[model samples]
Target: MTLVAYAGNLNNRANVWVSLLAEERRRRAVRAVAEQDHAAVWELVEAFMAFRSQSGVLTSVHTLRSYRTGVRQFLEYAAEHAVNVLRPGRDDAQRYINALVAGGKKVLTVRSRVAAAVTLYKALRWAEATEANPFEETFAPQDRMHALEKVPPYQERVVRRVLAAAQERIAQAQPDELDRATAVHTLLVVLAHGGLRIDEALNLEWKDIRLEDDELRLVVRSGKGRKSREVPLSRSAVEALRAYRALPRTRKHPPRKVFPFASRSSAMYHVRPLFDEHGVTDWRGFHALRKYMGSRLYENLEDFAAVAEVLGHANVNTTKAYVRVGNERARKVLRDW
Candidate 1:
């Protein structure tokens, strides 16, 4: 489907008088709607955009742009399929969703577009502009849950095996290569124990780590949404890091950062293979470490807010998606019952 055609066409209207600087930034949404072919749907889009602006719902310029782009695409799909935007049926909505998924759009993208469609309809409905709400019924009960989008947490056994491999590799390295081995070992431990995103781990400087007499912590400087939080470090991870820092390679030229690795790709070069060799499936990248941390923290602390805070998630529901209950725990709960 030509997703950009509707926006592109709308953006090129001869009568519209937008500044070149504004048009150059790909401002597809805020343009004046001069298209009379689909005036009915266009009117609804205008009303919805106005409503979003007035209700303070569109917090960011990005969100407003997304809603505009997505709604226009939906209208284009509706016009082509001979479906009424104001009174759409279940089949009409499903077809649009299916087309988006089949056309290789990410699930989240399709879902977000559908949500934009829903917001438009709701605004129209509230204004007595439409009688039906198709987008609401189009998504299944299960589809509304973001669980499928979540990264599957790493199995405890798999995590243990990966750590074991790192230790084994450290032991097998020659004396002259001990520093590299120590760095790799420490890297894996920091990820597994601290539950840091690979980028967060890569950004770690010596100053971020606090190896206090009674406690250890790593201050996450750059978290999701640029939020920062302090995460407790495991004893094993702290010790591994200590060993890595003491090595001749590290001591001779102390790193500006805690981990010797420079980039996420470079760190992954040393880290991913450990799991790859063990035939790990569903490789969720370093984010899985954060998921594992979320799950473990929830299990131990029984606090969603606390887990959300540590992971630097603004929403607790997002944290819920990150944490996964283990199969063993599920089976045990059932068996005891």
Candidate 2:
């Protein structure tokens, strides 16, 4: 389909702006290409990314940022080695893979960068800017590490320590610092109990939470890939949230958001020290908590589908990575045997 046709189908106000922006970027790229400008390659990359954005194929800011960085690295390598960005050969792709391996990049990192390069070629093909995709047959090295070894879930004891630390902070907080202390503690509680992504938890509003039949539940309006789902809150999570809500509001009219922090970094700023202090060093912030919830659910339910539903994973395969066999479970099984 033509770029105009692809963009024309969008009717929403936000998408209309995206379409216009993509069109402008495409025009600039086309002009640069016609003028034989060296900068045409970069313009084309921007236009391609804009097209992806307008098409709704790439929505996550983090993914877009990572892809841009990967693509830029590849472009720099191509320029240095006299490889044509517009029509790179398979040999060039292999050389790039070799360079990445030689640079001591992790297997996953190499794969991610290669995937980014492949996606860039796909964009170029969609834009009709290129007919070749050198990355089509290229492959990154295999990951030899076991799945559990890659990202192990936090043990129950460690999770308890983290929660205890948060609770202690709340208890010890002075009158003026109570609001922030409570918010941080509750944020961690929701992540641990609800199994929600950090972004999902951060985006939650007061309206999204519901109390039915004395059970607390959360409505995730938009999750990864724009999917929505309902998550049942654990008793501990509910209690923490209830305590947070009961705190006296400093402002007569406060924001409807569950947490007071605006950005992920802000949330982390309050909780990272707690996490580090309590032995959560390897995994990314907040995600380890989600994995902890997932592991516990799987251990109790023994059903992948049920755990997947709670975790809002569309594919059970993705859920598998989140569920780990805890030491306690292993010990129980051995003791029974």
**Residue-level lDDT tens digits of model 2 in 8-76:** 322332243335555564555445444545345443454455556543543565665677777778777
Clashing pairs in 1: none
Superposition TM-score, candidate 2 onto the true structure: 0.80
Give me the candidate number with maximum TM-score: 2
Cα lDDT, all candidates: 0.69, 0.76
Q: What is the C-alpha RMSD of each candidate to the true structure, in Å?
A: 9.7, 5.4
> Where in model 1 is the C-alpha error above 4 Å?
1-100, 109-150, 175-177, 250-254, 326-330
lDDT: worst 10-residue window of model 1: 25-34
- Residue pairs in clash, model 2: none
